[model samples]
Target: MKNIMNKTATVMAVHRERYELLAENHMFYGKLKTADFYNVNERVEFPTVGDEVEILFNETGDSLITKVLPRKSVFMRQTMGLPDQAVAANFDYVFITMSLNRDFHISKLERYLTVAWQSGGTPVIVLTKADLCEDRGRYLEQIYEAAPGVDVFCISSLTGEGIPEMEHFFAEGRTMVMLGSSGVGKSSFVNTLMGKEEMATGGIREADAQGRHTTTHRQCMFLPKEIVLPSGERIMGGGRIIDTPGMRKLIVSEVEEGLKSSFEDIEELAACCKFSDCTHKSEPGCAIRRALEDGTLSEKRWKTYQDMLREEAFSKERKKAMMKKIGKARKEIKAKRG
Candidate 1:
């Protein structure tokens, strides 16, 4: 085995213990070093799609990944009965995709925005299946109200409507990660952006309009500089796009900053309350209560914000408890060795 040390590569895909790496335009398979990653006292940061890593390259076989480089941004979600899972890393933008049909829910969008903002990447709302929605004005209005100061694009991947307006985000070297539930047209949007049918498209259930999982794994693809569409239109693309499997559950934890940013209006109102401890429930001089009474803040939005806070608190406690258990296990192992 010819070994080349300290070569850098980007993780393009991950499947359990195996990884597909891209380095200097060449693809190589990689596996983690057990000593460096698995047999450590502290928790190891596993490689994810879009992560830059140091590898001991092998010309004939799987390379040994030595270290995962620091990520500029990481998108993660909590998994029940397991640790927090990293979805993607080092992305510049998070495309929060949702369909305009039955799959669209304002509460879901708000939840996505909170996590997207917390990922250290700018969030851009991508509303897909415009061709299916006859009246999009109301939906757009709701989105604008919920996500002020964030960019939003409404596009139909089938017809290419609103596709041209999103070309600016595809500038060279920028990376975007698609985040949404299944059947949100993420694959279709990727194909359109690539100006070809590179990803498989699946149909949603007619009864509920939920999508089937067509993309099973997370993979990154480099976009060409120029993509010519079938409609004789061309898109200038030079960035990278990571397409991930649809997440069935997106649980947010330790997202205080994200919550504040997503619900800035509510935050500001709370700050204006007469008492810092005011709970907004039958409390005198509660700004939140006043806003609710006057209709400045919709009851539904306020309730969603509160629900997220409760969930976050619960998740944090669970994580703390899990960490304690892990620490105890490590101590027992050390005692045995001694």
Candidate 2:
């Protein structure tokens, strides 16, 4: 009983897909028995980062994760309009990592934050490699303007400056995952946490690119000691952190509600427009357009909001199709039983 409690406290995991799990942990995996978690195509379940699971093991300490716990929060994105094809779950915070040197994109940050908000996770901006930046404050200001109510932190793994401040997110039981474009310091941050060169260090290209993709899979690490150092100093540890592969494209799901959060100012302005369905571009008495004309609304921000909504609509259609198919299958099963 004491061992169970201790093991539960140290619940960091390295995930292999359900299929891979079968080959690796056969004795414990067999407890699930008879392909229960597998789909019709023989494909098995995959564990995403940030999943806390129940496991059973033999005396050797080898174990099988028998069941997945109820997730406190999930971050999901459907792949290519396939309703069943979804990924990512149970992240408390989403660190939208971007670089100050060259790999910065306001539109990408906006899109990432909207989806992050919709995923039931707080979004935080991580500006990696501050040593490379001549003026980090200017970059942070631009991000704050693009997405209000989000905390942006800058850190340099090379010099270790600004790194300790990042430990705030690792307080106690909370979990944060970093998602970003290739070569944007996600791996560098992970290396900082491991306190060794555990992760590959990528060099930024002279062509304005930041780094190579060092993290290929989503893996969680356990920080046993609170990084809050005692040398008349503070650092944080004893929480979970998952580093995911660099994602070039993170398509939004049914995140239309998130749009308001992302573009709150636009929505607020639209409410005062003379027309209810004011297409803010050309409509008279359009507050949004007025703002655009007078520099209140940046065209780039507005355009990204519009594109996100369109993609969101497509996601809803896919969900509707999935629901309709499920309904039909249920009806047919009932008729056959009758």
What is the lDDT of every predicted structure here? 0.90, 0.68
Task: After superposing candidate 1 on the true structure, give the runs of residues whose Cα lies further than 4 Å from its correct spot.
Answer: 1-4
| Candidate 2 lDDT by residue in tens digits, 1-338 | 45451111122334454311222323222123235444333344444556545455444545555555566666776666454432456768888888877778888888888878877788988888788899877777778789888888887766667767777787777778877888888877876766656556666577868455666666666554645232224476776677777776887877767787888988899899999988876888989888888998888888888888888788778788877886687678778778
- lDDT per residue for candidate 1 within 1-338, as digits (tens), equals 76546799999999878999999989989999889987737688989999999999888999999899999999997888688888999999999999998888999999999999999999999999898999999999889889999999999888888888898888898999999999898988888888777778788789987778888889888887986654668889999999988888789989898999999999999999999988889878999999999999999999999999999999999999998888898999889888
Least well predicted 10-residue stretch by lDDT in candidate 2: 19-28
Against the true structure, candidate 2 has what lDDT?
A: 0.68
Residue pairs clashing in model 1 are: none
The most accurate candidate by lDDT is 1
Candidate 2 stretches greater than 4 Å from native = 1-34, 39-46, 55-66, 81-88, 204-211, 228-234, 318-338
Q: If candidate 2 were superposed on the true structure by all CA atoms, what would the RMSD be?
A: 5.5
* Cα misplacement distance, residue 261 of candidate 1 (Å): 0.7
lDDT of 1 at 153: 93
